[model samples]
Every structure is written in C-alpha cells, then in structure tokens.
Target: MTVRSTAPKDTLGEELVRFDGVVKRFRTSLGRRQTALDGFSMTIPRGSVVGLLGPNGSGKTTALKALLGLVRADAGTIRAFGRQLPEGQALVASRMGALIEGPAFTASLSGERNLRLLGELHGVGAETVAEALELVGLTQAARRPYSGYSLGMKQRLGVAGALLAAPELLVLDEPMNGLDPEAVRDMRALFTRLRDERGMTIVVSSHILAEVELVCDRVTIVRHGTVIRDGPVGELLDRGTVHTVVRVEDVTAARSVLERAGLAVTAAVGPQGPELHVGATAADPGPALLKVLAEHGLYPQELRLRQASLEDVYINAIREADAARGATGAAGDVG
Candidate 1:
C-alpha cells in the first residue's frame, strides 16, 4: 500500500485540544537557556483515545503541562475545548480530570474519605465520589486506609479523583506505571468502557509501547522533544511494504527455492526450526511460495505475513534522527 504524506483531518471530526507552534523554555542554575519544547504543534480531536508516547525527557509531560496551563509556553498558542488555556483554564480544567504525576492524598485517610475531600474541593457531592470509586473498581477498597493501599489501588484512586467531576477530557500520565498484570488489564477495560460507554476523550501517556498499542485508537510518538509519527494505530502499523514469514523444516532449501523463484529473501534464522522473511509485492504469496517449496518436497510448518510494529517504526524514526544529527555534526566540523 502507498503511504500518504498527510493524515486525513476528518478522522476524529471535532477538535477538543490544539497547540499551534508552542514553544517552552527554561533557564538552568548556571544561566544557560534550555528549550524543552520547540514549535510543537498538534490537534487532539474530541472523544477519541490518543496515546502520547515518548522516552523520558521527550517533552511529553511538557506538552501536557502547557495544555493544562501549569507551565506557560514561551511562544505560540494553546487552546482547550475551543478556548485559550489558563485564561479559561479554570473553565477548561474544570472539564478535565488529569493525574500528571500521580495523585496526592492524605496517607492516613481512607480511600473513600480522600475522594470525599477531593469531591468537596471540586464542588461535587459524596455520591459523585462513591460513583467515581465504583467506576474505577475501587468500591471494595473504598474503606481501606490510603497507607495500606497497593500502588495499583493508589492509581485507581487517582483515576477516581479525575472522574469525580465527570470531566469531558481525561489526561493520564503513566497511569499504569506500577500496576500488576491484572491491574493493567482492568485499567484497559475501564478505559475502553469510559470511551465507548461514556464518550469521554482520553489521552494516555506512557513509555510502554505494547500497552499503548492495546489501549489507544491513535498514537503520537515523540523523540527528543519532537513528534516523529502521528496517525491511526492501524494505518501507522500498516505503513511500508508487506513481508511474509515462512517456517519450514529445511530452512536452507526453502531459501534456495524462494531465491530461485525471484523472491527477495530479507532475513533467515532459526534454532528449533528454520524461518525465512520474504518481501512480497502481493498480499497472498502463499500459493506461489508453497508450490516452490512443494517442488523440493519442503513442507512448511507455518506461513504468515508480518507488518512493522509501532515499536519498530518508533526505533527507525529515532535512528534516522540520530543519523541526521551525526551528519550535521560532521558537516559543521568540515566547515
């Protein structure tokens, strides 16, 4: 499939958040200027699940903090729910539930009490707090002291606090940071429910690519404070040409047969069995490859097509960036 230069704008339909060439910077203790974000621009559509992914110090948090008005952008514009941020920050933030670096609560207080206090601060009632607890599957742990709660429980409480106000947007930074496998699965299900049932637009930021793959409808990958890839999860994964994997009893013979058939064999490896990666021009290469293998009496155990994963794409983008930087350095030295 041919790759498009630009992503279709109407994919999500309505805009809930937008950043126009936003730049943020700070001064270090020694007085050197540090730029955290430079000309960052993005638009998050309403009611869509978006994954914000980056390595540590990639400005993912900076982008979120700027949108929330916790940090001001040195240049450009930011808007949330169609209003300029911080100016309408109170109004916009009131409609947003966020746990940027985990939620804070009194360790001595019970889960219910902590949420009760948070609800009162948000001008919500006790019933809202109880419902939020139930929504995050914390009802059974509601009476437990915050000090005794597990890391997962604390994360759930953070989510509960976000839900207390029935906000339109949910921005969670590493919500699954310390969660166990079961807790991660539960959180995934809860996010799905919140999106499909309640129609809440959720933005989840995490360094875990697989979890993001499972939870997000679309993903934006950032590296060194820049977005390298942004598009639908399916389309992004479907980028580049197609390839097939063949698992056969005789790896060597299979390679010979495929090569003779004019198929480009990209990779071949195996310990328990032999495997060959063949570049394909068509979707189904099974019939042609199978016939070639059969001619040599090489019956294959398995044959499947493989696509580049988000992790693979992300690594490639970073490698390209590194190469570009190196090239620039070399040119400067020559000059």
Candidate 2:
C-alpha cells in the first residue's frame, strides 16, 4: 500500500483516508444483527483537520476502527494514504497516530516513561519522545507519574504519545473530554499548530460541535451508520438559512410587512432594541431584506447577518435521517 500524494483538484489537499461503501454488522447474543456501518463513505483530505462527527452509536468510532484495522468491516474498502484497507493499513498505520476513546498507559510509570514505551513499539527514540512531549506542552510534567497528572494533563500526555511517531496523520476521538474551558481552548490551538506547522492531516471524532467548528477545515457527519453530510464545515453550515437580524423602530409594522413579503420573521428584545429575526434563503439575504424594509418605510437602526452554526446543520441531518428511517420502517411494515 502506498500513500497518495496528489489530491483531486476539487479537494483541499491530498487524499489521506477514504471509506467506500463500507458495511459492518455485529450479532447480538440474542442473534439480532446490529448494523454498525452501512455503506458509509467518506474521504479525508491531507494536511487538513477533518472532523468526524456524530452522536454515540452513529458508527464514528466504528469507522475509525475499520480505518485503523482495529476492526474488520463486514463489507467496504478502507484506505489510508492511497492504499486500501487491512492490506494497506500496516503501511499507512506507520504514517498515522491514534488516540482513541481513553488513554491507556502503566499508571505507575512516569509520563515520559510511558511515552518511551510506546515509542519503542514504533522504533521511535528518546529525542522523538522529548519532541512529542514538548509539542503537546507536557515537557514540564513528563517526569510525573501518569496517575498523579490532572485529567487535562493526562489527555495531553495521550496526545504526546500519539505524536511520538511523528505521524503524517493523527486520529483523535473526544480528545478534549474531561477538559476545562481553558484546556479545551489550548487543545484547539495545538491542533491548529499541528496543521500549520507539521501539515499533518487529522481525523477527530468529538461530541463537542463548537470545538469542531473552531479547528476543523472540513467535516464528515454520520448518522444511522451512514453519511448524512460531507463537505467543508462552512459549506455545510451555509446550506442553512442566512438570518438577517434587524433592530427596527417599529416592531409590529415591520413584522407584518416582512411577513407579507414572504420572509419568515420573529421578534425579540435584543441588546440594542426590538429586533426582527428574519430567515432568508442561503444566498445573500441582505439586499432583498432591505428592499422589503424600504418599501414598507421601515428603517432598521441596526442590522446583522448570522450564519447558521454547525450545530444547526448537525441536528437537522440527524432529524432528516430519523425521518427517512421512520418512513422506511413504515413502508416495510406495510409490505
């Protein structure tokens, strides 16, 4: 298996990881087959931090496991770099680092020693361990026993261990779990540094949508073991409404006029004054909004446009998937 160096012109960078129509199912003790992945397909671009986001049981971890060869898919091809899965995983794994759900180390050992041990597994030397520790802001705490470190420090150490390999790609699952607000902020900065300095690709699966929006260049959202949406974070979120918030002198008149013009409008007391919350099409909703406001002789003292958040896109995707699944189930029952 070889790494792919060139990406499609349309993508941000090289193609690092790809899952095509992958399927995996687990049989319960009662002999019920639970589908963990159903024809899931996603491509991770190189040198970009790509968020792999989904709710629990949405197969986020399962997808990572398959990509890393920690688990085999019942069906589908998993590729790392350019090499296809299982067969290419070893070669690609060498260029990749992973810190899954929890940090695992000999608790009694010092953080530095634990890193050394992990380094040995990858034939990494002491210098590499030191660099990794320094990179993850663990240099000062490296000599402390793993059990004595704070939860945030432990998370940082886990990240340090992953970096010991100086991998071309890093896979982190809920890396900021158990972190304080400051710690989360620091971790986000570190990921940005990794992308900016090392040009490493990252696949992060996290429940924290806000953090993902801050650090990820793009995102692949999964639900019901399949892709609900995949694209640049900005693009996916922009697919939603462009809300134009206006502070007008008259509330009732503005609302009536805007509503008559087919603009969905709501009102609330905002920081400045009474605000008109208007939902418009994905395109620039400003000009059309102004036209309607001017026609009604309503002038806005303040106007602001609020782009939809990634959370909005995520929740809607899940809702749509649920509706589709319910419809499918209903059709099956009828048959």
Each model's C-alpha lDDT?
0.79, 0.82
Q: Can you write out model 1's per-residue Cα lDDT over 1-335, one digit (the tens) per residue?
A: 11112213453448888888877777777776777776678778776889998777777888998887789888989998789976889877777889988878999999999988888887888778778888788999999899999888898899888887777788998898888888888888989987766677899998778878888888887755557778888888888456788998778888988898898985556464558888876878888888889988998898888787777677767777558758766211100
lDDT of 2 by residue, 231-251 (tens): 998888878656888888888
TM-score, cand. 1 vs. native: 0.80
Residue 152 of model 2: what lDDT? Answer: 79
Query: Candidate 2: misplaced stretches above 4 Å?
Result: 1-12, 245-278, 281-303, 330-335
After superposition on all CA atoms, what RMSD does each candidate show versus the true structure?
Answer: 7.3, 5.3
Distance from true location, Cα of 87 in model 1, Å: 2.8
Model 1 whole-model lDDT (C-alpha atoms):
0.79
lDDT score at residue 85, model 1, on the 0-100 scale: 77
